[model samples]
Target: MKDMVTPTMPVFEDMLAAHDRIAPHIHRTPVLTSAYLNGLSGAELFFKCENFQKAGAFKVRGACNAVFGLDNETARRGVATHSSGNHALSLSYAAGRRGIPCHVVMPRTAPQAKKDAVRGYGGLITECEPSTSSREAVFAEVQAATGAEFVHPYDDPRVIAGQGTCSRELIEQTGGLDAVIAPIGGGGMVSGCCLTLSRLGPGTLIFAAEPEQADDACRSLRAGRIIADDAPETVADGLKVPLKDNTWHFVSRHVTDILTASEQEIVEAMRLAWQRMKIVIEPSSAVALAAILKNPEIFRGKRVGVIVTGGNVDLDRLPWSAG
Candidate 1:
C-alpha cells in the first residue's frame, strides 16, 4: 500500500551510479548471437545473456544495487520482497552476499527450481496464492514481522536504476544498436532499458515485449495508462505481473512500442534458443525473441538487442513436457 504511491523517478544519473555500485557484485553478462537465428529473423540480433547471471536472471543486478545501496543501518534489518521467482532468488543472492537476512513471498505455483534457488541463496520463503492481492497481502505480513527493508521486485527506483545497468552494458558491449527489446512483466527491465537507452544510446528504439496471454503492458501502452490484471495464464510466468506506477512512468515516456506473442510462439522461441544458440532461457525471456520472430518486418536488417532475461527453469516442468 505504501509503495503504491508513485515514487520519484530515478534519473539517468542514478542508473549510472547503480551500474558502478553493482558492477563488482554482479556479472556483466555476455552479449551472444546465433547466426542461424539472425538469418531467420532477418536482423542482426544480439542477445544479452542474463540467463547466465549470478542468480540465473537479470533480476540480480537490481537486487544487488538495492541491497548494497542501502545504508548500513537500514541494511542491517535485511531485505524483503515478493516475486514470482527470479527476483526472490536474486534478492536472496544479493542479501547473502551482504551477510544479511532475506525474506521472500513467492507464489505457490512458482516453479520448484526457483523456490529451491531462493532457499539455496538463504532466503526465507513464505508461500502466497498466485495472485496480485495475495502476494501483496502476504508480503505485507512478512515485512511487518521481519521489520525488513522492502525491495520490490520491479517497482522501486533503486531496482530500476539497477536494471538500467543491463542496457548500459549492452550498449557498451555491442557499441550501438538499432533497437532493444525486453520482456515487460512489471516493466522493470524494459523501464531500465528505456532509461538507459534514452540517455546512453538515444538513437536506439526501445520495445517492450509481452505474452499475449498477459498483455496488460501492451494494453496499458495503448490505453495510455496502467491497466492492472489479476491473473493471466501463460507459460511465461515471470511476466504475469502488471506494470506499477514508477515503471509505468518510464514505459509510457520512452518505450517506442509494446509487442506481444502467443504462448505457442513463446515456447517455440525458447526451444529455438536452446537448440540454435545452445543457451538455456526461461519462457519469460523467450517472449522478446518471440516478438521479434513474429514481427520480422519491423526488425528486418536492423541490429537489435534482445534481453535474454533469465535461465531458471524447473527441469521436471519444462513447457514442452506438459502433455
Candidate 2:
C-alpha cells in the first residue's frame, strides 16, 4: 500500500452552508422506520430514504452544491465528471436545473437506464472503458475541450460538504442516534456521516457498510492506510470504486468500523427492504442493511440510522431475478 495524506475535510459549518444552498433544489428526504426490519435486526432502525431524492440518489445533493456553487463565468464553462452511474445523472440533473452544459465520462458498461437518465437531463455523454484509467483519460480530454470545472464524484470539498447534509438532517430529525451506518462506495456518504456525526452527534458511533466483493474501504480501515482496488466486481455496481484522499481522511479518523456483506446477503436484504418497507432501493443501498443483519451484536438494542443511497435499478435486470 502507498502512503496516504489526510486531505482537509468539510466541517459542520460547511454542511450547514450546503444544506442552505441546496435547500430549494433538493428534497429533504424522509426518515422511515420498519417494524419488521427493526425486529429482525434487534435494533431501532431509521432509514434515511435518499432513494426518494431527485435523480433517485443522494448524489444529487453534492451535484447541486457543486453546480450552484460556481460563479457565472465558471458556470458558463459548465461542469464535468466521470461516474459509472448515479453521479452522472445527478450532475446532469443539477446542470440542467442551472441551464448549463454538463459533460460526463461514463463507463460503457454502466446500466442503460442510468445512461438514459443522464441524457434525459441533457448531459453530454462520453463513453469510456470500464476502468479507472480509461475514465480519467477520457475525462481529461473532455475537460480540456470544454474548459469545464472538474467536480469529482467524491473527492471535492463542495461535494463532501453536500453529502454531509444528509447526516445533519438525520441527526436533527431523529434527535439522537446510537450509531449511523451507510454504504461506502467511494466513501462519499460515509465520509459525510463521519463529518457531521463527529462534531454534532459526538456520542454516536459511525460505521461504514460495503459489499464483500468491493471491500477496499474495510481493508483500508483495518490496514490504517488507503487501499485502491483495481476494478473489483460486485452486483452493487455503484460501489466498485475505492476511497479517494478526501474521503479517506474522514473514514480513517471518525468511522468506528467497516463491515461487509456477501452478494447473497445483499440480494436478500434488498428483497427484505422492498417486501417490508414498501420501498424500492437499489442493491447498493441494501449493503447497509445487510451489514447490520450480518452483525446483530454490534447494533443490538441500539438506535441505528442507515442511509439508503439510491434507487436507480434497471427494472429488467433486477439482481434477485437471477433465479
Candidate 3:
C-alpha cells in the first residue's frame, strides 16, 4: 500500500471551482426519488442519475473538464487517455467537440457500445490486452506517436474536482443527507464526492462501496497505505484500477468506511434496479445500491444518496443474464 494524500477543507473550494467550469459543458442530471425504494429500504434515498448524463455516464463530466482545462496550445494538439469504456467515450466526445484529436487505448473487453461511441466521436482507438501493463504501454505508444497530452482516466486533480460535482449537486438537491454512497474504482469519483460533502454536508457520512473481487481500495484504506499492484479481477470491469496516490489520500481522510459487496450481490442489485426502478446500471454502480439494499440497518430511517455511475452496458453481453 502507498501513503495516502491527506484531504482538507481546501478541496471543497476546488470542487466549487470545478463545478463552475464544467456546469456549462455537462448535464445537470436530475435527482430522482423512488417511493418504492424508500419503502423497501426504510430510508429516504436520492439517486443522482449520471446514467442519464451526457455520454450516458458521469465520465463526461471529468473528461470535459480535463480537456477544456487544457491551455489553447494543448487543446489544439488534442488529448490522450486509456479506458475500458465510459471514460474513453467521454474523452473522445469531448475532444471532438473541441475539434481536436483524441487517441484512446481501449482494453479488448471494452463494451462494443462504448467503442462505437468513441469511433463515432472520431477518437482513434488502440486495442490493448485488457490488463494494466497493456493499457499503460498502449497509452504510452499512442502518446509518443501523436504527442497528445495525457488525460488520465482518474487521478488528475481536475478530474477529481469535476467528479466532485456529483456530490455538490447531491447536497444541493437534498439539502441535507445523512450519508452518501458511491462505488470506488480508481477513486476519482469518491475523491470528488468526499471533497464537497466534507464541507456542505460535513455532518454527512461518506461511504465507498467496492466489489470484493477487486478490493484493493478497501484493503489499502484499512491498512492506511496505497496498493498499486495485483488488482484482482472482477465482473465490474470499471472498478479495476489499483489505488492511486491522490485518490487513496482523499479516501483515507474523508471517507468514513469502505463496504464490500460480492459479485452476486452486485448482479442481484442490478437486476433489482432494472426490474424495480426501470433504470439500467453497470455492476460497479450497483455496489452502492447493493450496500443500501442488502444492509438496510445502516441507512434505515436516514436520507441516503447514491450515484448511478453509468448505464452504457453492451446489450448482447450484459454482465448478468437479464432473462
Q: Taking the tens digit of each residue's C-alpha lDDT, what string does model 3 give over 62-142?
A: 888888878899788788877657888888878887789999888878767777788987889899998778877877778
Would you list the C-alpha lDDT of every candidate in the order shown? Answer: 0.91, 0.90, 0.82
User: For model 1, how big is the CA root-mean-square deviation?
Assistant: 1.8
The sequence of per-residue lDDT tens digits that candidate 2 reaches over residues 1-323 is 01111145678898888889999889999999999998999999999999999999999998998889889998999998877588988999999999999998888897777778889989999999987678778988988899888888888778999999999999889999999999998989988888788888999999989999999999999999999898799999889989988898899999999999999999999999999999999999999999999999999999999999999888888888867
Better of 1 and 2 by lDDT: 1
- Which digits, one per residue and each the tens of the lDDT, describe model 1 over residues 1-323? 55532378899999999988888899888899888999999999999999999989999999999999989998898889876478888899999999999998889897777677789999988999987789888988887887889888888999999999999999999999999999999999998998888888899999989999999999999999999887799999999998988899999999999999999999999999999999999999999999999999999999999999999887777898798
TM-score of every candidate: 0.95, 0.95, 0.91
Better of 1 and 3 by lDDT: 1
Model 1 has a clash total of 0
| lDDT of candidate model 1 versus the reference | 0.91
Candidate 1 residue 81 Cα shift, in angstroms, is: 1.1
